[model samples]
Target: MKAGFSAFERYKMKGRFKWIAAAAAVILCVGLLFACKKDKGKEQEDISESTEAQAQAQASGEEGESEPARAEEEDPNKLEDGMMRSYLSGLPVDEKIGNRRPVAIMLNNLEAAQPMSGISKADVVYEYVVEGGITRLMGLFENYDDLDKIGSVRSCREYFVYTALEFDAIYMHFGQAAYAVDLLAQDYVDNLNGLGEAGDTCFYRTTDRQAPHNVYTSASGIEAGIKKLGYREDHYDGYKGKFKFCDLNEVVTNEGGGSAKHIEPDYKINKPWFDYNEKTGKYDRYQYGAPQIDELTGEQLSYDNIILQYNKWAQLDQKDYLAFDCHSGGIIQYCTKGMFTIGTWRRDVDSAKDGNVDMAPVRYYDMDGNEIEINNGKTFVCVIQDSALEDIVLE
Candidate 1:
């Protein structure tokens, strides 16, 4: 009986120990679950706080942290206002205007045609000797919508036509020299001649000036002539610009360059010169002992860049029609920001055989063989005879 009571007591004690172990195990599991839930809640709180801070930062316009992502997707060459860079001026312009082909109009630079109308608006201007020690002007206008009177239109020279080709411009003139007739009649030359069938529609004589110097073309007349001729109004599909320009916001000082505060291209006639204006950062033009003012605007003509392109030239015939070596390489002097630099200008002569010569731009390179950069504005190019290079004075 004593041994049976001892076994029963041992069994009861074992059952109590088992119950206590199971209760402790359940309490430990509950505590672990609560701790995991608290940890998950803290993680969610951290995420919520981070998002809220970002939103606040954005609202306060302190979004510098996110700028890198936005900048990565933005185009460095394009302006924020959806304006396109102009091929001629390297300035912001409407896309339609920027993409259209520029017009190269020949202007009479005789003393009788002083104060030329609409000349100040030209994106680029070329001055070269025509004949009899006289100089003629070829103004390239990229945007001429508001120009009422563009020129006292003059005849075209073969060399002027080639210069116009460099810009892929629609060559415009009242007439052409005999030497230019064969070249102008070619299919590649898209010119609006005042002496041709489009004459009545594209040009008119102003009573304010005399016969040869009175012939003028307006913006409407140019548009009408282009529409009547059915010429392509836009630039070529793969037309990269002729010039490489600096950014609009940037200014190139031409550091350590030669002084170009005053430029005098001493032609036998007209005697054109330029004075650098510190206030406007442009070269103010002067010719025939006075400012080269625009008749319509009453404003003097100015340019951001001045290029002296020296080329081998010759008189073609007894009539003295001039021919310049446009296809050949030549010495070039580029001036801007009151300073000047020497460079070389070249064009691929082989391109002429491929019928794509006009599409090839005359490239400019420094002595180091690197392409030179031009400022963003109107340019004045003086096509001087290489023999007369010493006549040019840059003070």
Candidate 2:
């Protein structure tokens, strides 16, 4: 009877051990779950902080906003003729990332009553290192998605002025707008006479009257030109309709056949909402803040493959350049000698609410903070132009 009791006691001890094991497993799982939650929260906070920093930078028109606003917003500091300011009075020239502000100092030391053909006009001259070779024109506002900055006709005209200075062609980086074209007509003539250099003369903006392919020197012609440069419309752009050739993957991984040298590494990563992971060395493509799916594979699209497709449809050249407006592809394929980053503007405030403000319907402010009234709701000028060559065409 004693031996039987001992065996029974041993069995009960075994049951206790099993219960303890189960309890430990439960506790481990809960700890792991909480750890994961903490990590996720940290990542989210980092992203939020980064976003807020960019917002402050844009509104203040300075980097970091680490410093307070200048006591005098309107300082008399001017740039020399042909030289430009990076920000109106905010950042130094060439240091700014995107075209944060449309206004810039035209003259090195002189001020302008209004833009000469939409180019910054001042008597004192400022000089920048000439960049080279453009080949296409695009209208994209993806970079400006944060502030919803899609440019209008005036902004596009500003693109033309800078583009003319950068590329070899006379009609590459342009958009559709007659009003801007008229403004360019005036500005181009004025600058050529004064400085002997009309940087954006080759580009222009046209209105609906120039539709079906009038602007950008005829869209149909531009399409044909792209094909000549070896753009396969079907294979490129991932079979998406529209002959935009911004595939950076196809450009860098083309088995090295054509003018692929111009396209740099991971250049497409500059597009907004596109993420490049250095840890796993993978690219993430998103649409509307969600992973976009490949129609055929039923899987999330990879940035590598998508960029490869864009490169296939791209246009490449040394002397030519591209200009874009407010669309996605419009900005990525920056195959130009120089880039003209433009922001669009409409009356942010209602005229009724503005108390008859003296500002124009669409005012053109210079880098100096002086306002130039644009009565017809439009302004034009060269924001950035490259001097890759000496052969410039006059209109």
Candidate 3:
């Protein structure tokens, strides 16, 4: 019976060993499958990482190549379609018009010269007090090809010639003040005087007005005079423009500025004022209690920017012909977008390499000493006596 029990135990042990062997074989097969999957997954992950690295490298190379081109496209100074910005208005214009020098025509602002012809085409207008508390207008026209009549043209003041020099403009006048004769005779001063040899070629007298107020100029006459005089029609090779302008789509709100809904320069004569028009986003001009309109278009004169530049001034002689210190620094009131900024203006005459004061631009700066950026449109600049600061009003 002991021998029989031993045999059964041996058989049971053998069966148990067979079952354990089968279990071992199953475990080894499962381990092998898991190892194969892990290796396959690692290989796939390595490929993915390599591809990602290559893609990143390609992207970086592309970004490096396109960055400058993209920046150039975004540049505000860059224009499209062979166009250039107007130095006078800061608006886009033809390359030819933008490159040419502007014509600065003197306009009579007296009551008799009401509804001045072709004055609306002026990109920039300057008003300065002359003798007898009266102000004269100097209109700087950049694109005047279509203008048939400009100004009831008036006499030039020495100060006006200096102002025209700031823009490198070709000065045009029917006559000049006696004090201006010597200055106008200077070789650097290229002016078309109606009383000089170019008078018949550059200007004509209208039948409707008296002698002094009757002189007028046209685009054809101006072109004729320019050709006859052989004046340089193009701007200087490296001429830097005055008045930095905002981009085409940009709008300067004059941040931290004062209200400028109504501006009154408080001139004793003419009594010129500006009222902000919300609809047109411009300041409509009024003088002598009436809208200042252009005779050619019959449209009321308006401006996008108005500058009241207060300068130290003196009477030259008994005639009251004034001399404004254009080189010296002065207080400035710059108004735009129904807002006004108190600033300062200075022309660095001493810094001019050529010793030409007219070539120096009168730069405007804010209280913080940052150059003020004006809007892109027609501008009206009023040269007021510094003592008359109290007389000026802005609301």
Candidate 4:
């Protein structure tokens, strides 16, 4: 019985060993398959990383690639908005900037003349506070199509400082010059030589079209330039040069839309001085009429008379007087002394005091771009042209 039990135990032991060996082999095969799968996944991940790195390096212009563009930023306007957009991180232009980003709407619009195409003599006139010289002379003609080939003003756009309000820039050309010229103290013509013409290229940036072009030379040339180059008014139906000029006497709507009092100019600039002494002083203020360089010139005019004549006109017409000096371009032509001086004489006071004029004469200059721009000695004419603003007229 004992021998039979020993045989059964040995057979059971062999069977158990065989089963354990088979299980071990299966475990080994599973481990090898998992290892191969991990190795293949690692290889694929490396290839994907390499491709991504190569693409980044190309965009950065590295690895013998062409150099990226140097930053050449220029301010379109000194306005706060312009500066913010160009320099700030989150600006529209900055967000859309390269890696070859799409062009902006404004940039695209600027490329097209659509913003400027439609203008009329009555609708818009982009005025410039310009100095005389070839710029003013050439500007008088406005758009020169023949000169456009030579970089006429058309190559450049304009920003306008409407009356007292600055930074409200509009894209104006051609008839725009007319508005600027009319406000520019008329003495701009007198200062042409002071602007200093160089060989052949135009240099005045504030006034000239762009640069390096001298297509027109005189007032007639300026007029021709306007016609030949197709003025903004010519392109658009509603526009006329009239929008450039404003009559101080006329009441107009507030475009920017604000209080009618503050926004609507009271011609207070013209009468700035009138308010000063009218309240506290005598009922009649003193202003000298027709300030002349010569006390005995009868008409009270300078040796060259235009400046003094202008001052005299100011006294009579607007009660605003200016002095003339040799320094003032237009008034200098009429200087009696090397420097002529003028004062305000209240005519109303003078009449009451038996020709005794009350004066508040000052030394003024044109550098400030005031109504009286010349040295306090120079005067300006208050010549107001009362013509109908262009009412949608065309040739």
Question: Which has the greatest TM-score?
Answer: 3
Q: How many backbone clashes does candidate 4 have?
A: 39
Global lDDT of each candidate: 0.79, 0.23, 0.80, 0.20
| Cα lDDT of model 3 by residue, 1-395, tens digit | 01111211333445531221222232123222210000112233445776677667677774445434323446756788879989998999998999999999999999988879999999999999999999999999988999888889989888898788888889999887876776787766789999898999999988898877888999999999989898999888767678888878676767556788999997889999999999999999999999999998989999999999987666655777677766657778888878887777998564342667656778887766777888899999999877777667888
Model 3 poorest ten-residue lDDT run: 32-41
Model 4: residues >4 Å from true position, as ranges? 1-158, 161-217, 227-235, 240-395
Best by lDDT: 3
Cα lDDT tens digits, model 1, 1-395, are: 01111211333445521221222232123222110000112233455777788768888988775454433634436785657999899988888888888999999999998879999889999999987989999999989999888889999887788788888789999888766776787777789999997999999998987888899999999999999998889987767778888766566666656788999987888988999999999999999999989999999999999998887665555676666767657777788988887777898434332456654678777766777788889999998877776667987
**Per-residue lDDT of 1-395 in model 4, one digit per residue for the tens?**
01111211333445531211222232123222110000112233445777678767777866444735548855432234322221101122221121111100000011111112111101111111122100110111122222212112332211121111111111212222222333222211111111222212221222333232322232233333334433322212211111111122221121221111111011111111111112321111111221212111223211111122111100111222111111112211111112222222111221211221211112222222222222111112221111111110101
Cα distance off (Å), candidate 4, residue 107? 29
Question: Which residue pairs in model 3 clash with each other?
Answer: none
Model 3: residues >4 Å from true position, as ranges? 1-73, 348-353
RMSD of each: 32.1, 29.0, 33.4, 40.9
Q: Rank the candidates by TM-score, best first.
A: 3, 1, 2, 4
Model 4 lDDT-worst window of ten: 100-109
Ranking by lDDT: 3, 1, 2, 4
